[model samples]
Target: MKLSNSTVLVTGGSSGLGGATVRALVEAGAKVVIADVNIAAGEALAAELGDAARFVPTDVTDEAAARTAVDAAVTLGGRIDGLINCAGIVVASKAVGRQGPHDLASFTRCIQINLIGSFNMIRLAAAAMQAQDANDAGERGVIINTASVAAYDGQIGQAAYAASKAGVVGMTLPLAREFAKTGIRVLTIAPGLFETPMMDDLPEAAREALGQMTPFPARLGKPQEFAALACHALGNTMLNGETIRLDGAIRLPPK
Candidate 1:
């Protein structure tokens, strides 16, 4: 789908990877709706982008909130052309450590937000997209999900995080196939270490060390880079049902 004049909904859009995507989509001439729990950041971004963007408070895991976000996008742009799932959390806990078994609640929370939340947005956005007329390419909309390299090369402390991301990767093909008849495409982007808000908790040296681990470019991935890939995926209809790795050939080691 051509981004120019299209309408896209982005979750977790208040900051980090989702924030970059919102800016990029608006720059591409697409109307954007920022769906996030961060009211302050979301509203600020929407204001910064002017009429091209709107902020709708959303909890991706909640059905009503997700639907509201979709409705807001449709209202703002007249039709929803795309949905990007960028809302997620990271939980680093060893299954067996000094604390005994990892907190089950943390594991469940990670799954709820990272996995189930993504699906909530997908289902609602897709339903709205199906109601719209297809473009010349018989495409009504496209959906991009955010997975992680951890899903493939999970570290020792990433059981919850890895499992959640893995679920996202697992859903891509089946969702794409199911949506084929309706002209909506589903895809996932499994990114490696990147400079997102989630990385802020690390010390500067630690973050730098992690970046140097990448085989090439030898630095942390940028949010804009991820956004660029998302834009590309939206434009490339043949790229459906696939999980593309945005990592710089980095196979994470167990830590």
Candidate 2:
């Protein structure tokens, strides 16, 4: 869909990748809804963007909250034309560690937020978009989900994170097919070693070393790059049901 005047909902839009997407969409003339749990960041971003955006406090895993966010998106621009699932958490723990088996709670939490949370937003947004009239191309909306390269080249400590992201990649095609009848395309973007908050806690040297892992360019992926791809995916109706890896040709070692 054309970004101009289209309404899109972005989860985890308060910061990081989602924040970049929200900014880019606004710049492209799209009305955006920032759905995130971070109230301060969300409100501040919406304020900064003026009338082009709205901030809705949302926990993607909670159905009620997600629905509220959807409603807010519709209210912001009169209809929902796209949905970007960017809310996720990373968990690094071996299945069997020196202490013992990895913490089950942490694994479950990762899955709940990354996988289930994405689905929650998709379901609700699809329903809303379905109610709207389709364009000449019979396109009502587009949905983009965020996965991780860990799903494919998971390191030794990435069992939980990998599984959760893998689930995202696994669902793309099926969701695309199912939503085809409604003219709502589904796709996923699997990012690798991006400069996100997840890497913020690492030492500067550690972060630099991680950036060096990418084969080409030899640097961390930028949030703006991810946003550019997201906008491109939304506008290109032919791109659907595929998990496009935004990685810079780097495959993780066993570690």
Candidate 3:
């Protein structure tokens, strides 16, 4: 699918990888909708991207909110061309911990936002895409989901995060098959540790240590690298129903 001049919706577009993807799409001439819980940041980004971009405050966990965001994008741009599911949460805790017990509520919250939230957006966006006319490549839409390296190499304290991301990995193939008939494609990206606001909360030494874990390049992955892959996935029709790991040969060890 050609990205330029297409209507693209990016969840979690207020920060991190999502923000980078949004910027890339906008620069590539795509009309983008920044869907995020951070209203100020989202609106600010939309403004920064100029006329082709709009922001819609969205709580992806809520079905209505997800649907509304997609609807708003379609209504404003006249069609839905692509969706990037970048909204996710990470809860670092052992499934059975020495410090009391694992917080079930926290675990559930991770699943709700990271796993179910992605599904909600994909379902709503796909439905909207299905109603639109297919493009020259016979494509209706493309969906890109964010998973984590934890899904494959879960550290000791990442049970909930791993589970949520694993669920995302599990859904990719099936959803792709389901949407195939409608000319919609589903893909997932499992990312390695990167320098995002989330990682900024860590001390410098800790961040350096994490970066060293990468086998080659031996540094933290860049948000732009993730955005590049996303754009590649969107344009390369053969890439679908697959979860590509963006980790730099880094198989995280149990902490």
Q: TM per model? A: 0.99, 0.99, 0.98
C-alpha RMSD for every candidate: 0.6, 0.7, 0.9
For residue 209, model 1's alpha carbon misses the true position, in angstroms, by 0.3
59-92, model 3: which lDDT tens digit per residue?
9999888988998889868999999999987798
Local distance difference test scores for all models: 0.96, 0.95, 0.92
Provide the lDDT at 142 for model 3.
98
Per-residue error for 173 in candidate 1, Å, reads 0.3
Write one digit per residue (lDDT tens) for candidate 1, span 134-236.
Answer: 9999999999999999999999999999999999999999999999999999999999999999899899999999999999989999999999999999999
Tens digit of lDDT per residue, candidate 2, span 122-239?
A: 9999999999999888999999999999999998999999999999999999999999999999999999889888889999999889999999879999999999999999999999
Off by over 4 Å in 2: none
* Collision pairs in model 1: none
- Comparing 1 with 3 on TM-score, the higher-scoring candidate is 1
